[model samples]
Target: MFKPLWVRSLFIAFTALFLAAPLMAEDVNLSERAPSFWKAEGQDNTVWLFGSVHVLTEDHYPLADKVEEAFEQSAYLVVETDVVNVDPQAQQQLMINAGMLRDGQTLEDVLGEARWERARSLAADNGYDLEQMAMLRPWLIALVLSVTELERMGYTAAHGVETYFLERAEREQKSIVELETLQFQISLFSDMDRDTEVAFLMQTLEEIQDLEAQMEMLVAAWESGELDKLEETMLADFADYPEVYERVVTRRNHNWMNDLTRFLDEGQQDYFVAVGALHMVGEEGVINLLREAGYRVERQ
Candidate 1:
């Protein structure tokens, strides 16, 4: 099953949209480009929404003053999930339990001979051991292949937007919160039907060959807050794959709305909410959802 560059791009896009960032750049000039940050006013407090890159180069750092100020003022930092606090061992165990194939099945049995061979070749080219990787399901394989390629490109989660704030939140002892758990996030991929998972893996393999260039386009759109370019590059083509978009972006955004809006209504404290940049744009995005719900949301 073939997919477009944008569809394949989602495999990489999810890196930023979900797990983490983009193609590691040698230099990222943030002086002129507006940060993907916005503000929503509440009756007593405010909510700051910063579109985050899950993994990024060290050069992306020294966040914009607007973003920094929001964090400084807010009492709580909210992310999709608090991955930093998850125990490493437990994290590994969860992946194992969730991704492992059934006892009687092998990856070849699932992906079929030709497709399995293609996956094996892709894995080796990406420096993953096919034999060990063969034990997992398609979604898990796709996840591993994508992340490993990003790491090879020098983009890493340690330098991600959430990781940066998460560490500081721990040091300064600021309150940290999660919109979802790691388990729930993982389940999003794991629960896909078998055919969809196969297509996902296959397109992902095709996508990563030119992953760096594709991500550069995505990161540029994200960095400059060019909503049109972002929508075109990241979302427009999803008209053909609405189910994936609904599953990966829409439903999750709606689910997060309850928690996101509560910060405003509770009047307890301001929140600096950061999720993947994709969640902040489009008609169904969290920002618009906030606007539709009658809050004053402005780009910062």
Candidate 2:
């Protein structure tokens, strides 16, 4: 039914860590450690920006009451993607397409022996075989690897903020707009080099041991809404993998910023914009960039 039990478990653990720490100092600034919700009140429009952790557990969510209220008050819900109403078959197809590698390539050829062996060990620990994941794209592999590790630790997408909002939007008939398409998101991964992909996978495997502790600190900071700490920790970790960081984080932030401006200008409706928390921090973050663009962004 699920990808695998271990994969599911890893997502659960990962989500739990994110929810447990609402705020922490190790990876974020104390002031920014608060919730990533902001409101830009204007004479004609009110925009609420929410920093969101994509995946979580049911027990950790609904967010705060204020968050729910914000949603209720908003005229529209804007998400990174409109996964809420995506066709089941289309979504599955996207995942399957994202997982496939180019015809000639194999995981072993790309990862080499030591790394491949480590991947095999990781697979075994998670109750699967490395070969099973061989044809998966590097980016998809990275996502799967991350989700699997978190699942082993106990995080689940079932409880993720995005998933929750998606459910709510469906029930309430709220209008939902996608900031980007799944195809665009998937293309980011397809653009990466084979070596970079292999390196990312290997690095992720190596980090598995410290994943819990690191995630704990990150989660605490995130829950507390400490943007600075979260930014610092995430950036430091990102520096270790520039390829993945550039593709997944940096580029996407830029793209989202462009969409935000267009959305604000055209929609003319109150919106609750929920995106990954990480995208809302750092110099290149949406919040900071929005401020630079002359929009007054205040924490709510």
Candidate 3:
């Protein structure tokens, strides 16, 4: 599931948002090249769509001038889910309600003996007590493992792309819009098929062994603004899992198309739409979907 550097990069960052605190941004020279930026030109107002890495290391800032310029010009900041504004207690409750198994079901029951032992060993190696996570669903456990592994490598949600933009937006008093509720995002994990969830957890555990290399490749691709490379690295790993890919990536993109179209149709206020970088790539992504609707979506 996390084969691509960016998808894995953001997924872990997304999980860490609940536990991490905001931090001040570092001062640095503007990057020569940053992640991809697109413009969805409308009859009147325009929407600037930027691909966001949910979690990042300190080195990811300061963003390229184009990103800052887009933020400066737009009236609103729209994201998949506005983590920065949500209450910590409410967010935690949302996760618990969606990610915990009911009745007598334990994580060990979901993972089985052999896989459960492997999970325990992995957690132990990383200095975590797996027993504390026995009540969490496999999807939640996968997130725990990912967040722990990413933290060990120095990535933090405090430095994520959305957090960066969100902080600046707050200082500037920009209006924020959420495409989906926090509960909606949590349900993506809660609704997973049991077998698929276990396989997803196992795959994440396998990928942890190569976390360093994966991070390197992903960070480089993101900073270089290589959209093709990003799509390949992110989507190739999930080709075999059509159901997961469809649900996690394709379906969400489909669902967002209408809301995105309304932004264009309204043409009343300009928008700076920042979402996970994964949503901007591939054929079924918002970029092509908008193009298919007869709007010019250009890389800016």
lDDT of 2 by residue, 106-140 (tens): 87777778778888897677566778778776556
For candidate 3, write residues 10-109 as lDDT tens digits: 7321321221112322442445565778998987888999887787778667888888888899889998888788799988888788888899899888
Off by over 4 Å in 1: 1-32, 124-129
Q: Please state the error at residue 225 of candidate 1 in Å.
A: 1.8
- For model 3 the local lDDT of residue 214 reads 69
The lDDT per prediction is 0.75, 0.64, 0.75
Number of backbone collisions per candidate: 5, 44, 0
Estimate the Cα RMSD of every predicted model relative to the unseen true structure.
3.3, 5.9, 4.1
Per-prediction TM-score = 0.90, 0.82, 0.90
